[model samples]
Target: MMALYNGDEKDIREFFRVYCNFFKEQGYDVVTFEACIGMIMPGAGALGDSRVIPVIQEEDDFRNYPWDDIPELYFKEYSKYFRALREEMPEGMKAIGGVGNGIFECVQDLTSFQGLCYIAADDEELYHNLFKK
Candidate 1:
């Protein structure tokens, strides 16, 4: 995942410039630059080294997810970043929308893989509602 360290447009631009230049210098033909806002989750836990534990442990937590309330603001911020990234894209490089995990994948990320399966089978309403959000 790409992160804007300073959350500044200039830094964002410079990041892409340096990234694309590095690839160009390596003689690789880069064609597209993709961006995404990433998944929204309550919190995360670190497992031994490279794994994470999702913070949403129960149905109530999923139902009360804060992102459900102010998605418009999130989209607005995402658009601003998209526009800035697009402007900084290397000439001739096409801008592509990054792939986002689907609802099922999101549920798995918010909860655990086993928890997601159990919830979907045991509480159909909650399962559907989680995705609706």
Candidate 2:
């Protein structure tokens, strides 16, 4: 959650300035930041050592996923961070940032690596549809 939250935008711009300036003062030309997709996912611990349960083990799981809400959820959770990063970049400095997990990583996170391997064999269409989602 902290990764997605940059605090309240109006209240956090000053902190953003401070954050970017620290790296600039340290002789860095760019600051790096990212927001992970797992924040919005319902069951997403597959990326770490937590329980390896997968969210999309079947076609029904994929079909039932709230795909339409993802964009809105992402915007609400992370757009301000990107805006702040751009606005707060130091002079002569740039930023490196990523919005969320890529398709591969997201799918892997939604389905544990082992689960993905099973999906590949057990249900090819469901596996493909998971990615299509």
Q: Quick one: RMSD of model 1?
A: 4.4
Per TM-score, the best of the predicted structures is 2
Candidate 2 deviant stretches above 4 angstroms: 1-11, 49-52
Cα distance off (Å), candidate 1, residue 31? 5.1
- Relative to the true structure, candidate 2 reaches a TM of 0.78
Worst 10 residues of 1 by lDDT: 41-50
Could you estimate the TM-score for every candidate? 0.59, 0.78
* lDDT to native, each model: 0.58, 0.80
Off by over 4 Å in 1: 1-8, 20-40, 44-58, 69-81, 90-93
lDDT of predicted model 2 = 0.80
As a TM-score, model 1 comes out at 0.59
lDDT of 1 by residue, 10-117 (tens): 777677677667766776655344432234344522211125765565678775667754456446556555666566666766555453445566556666676667
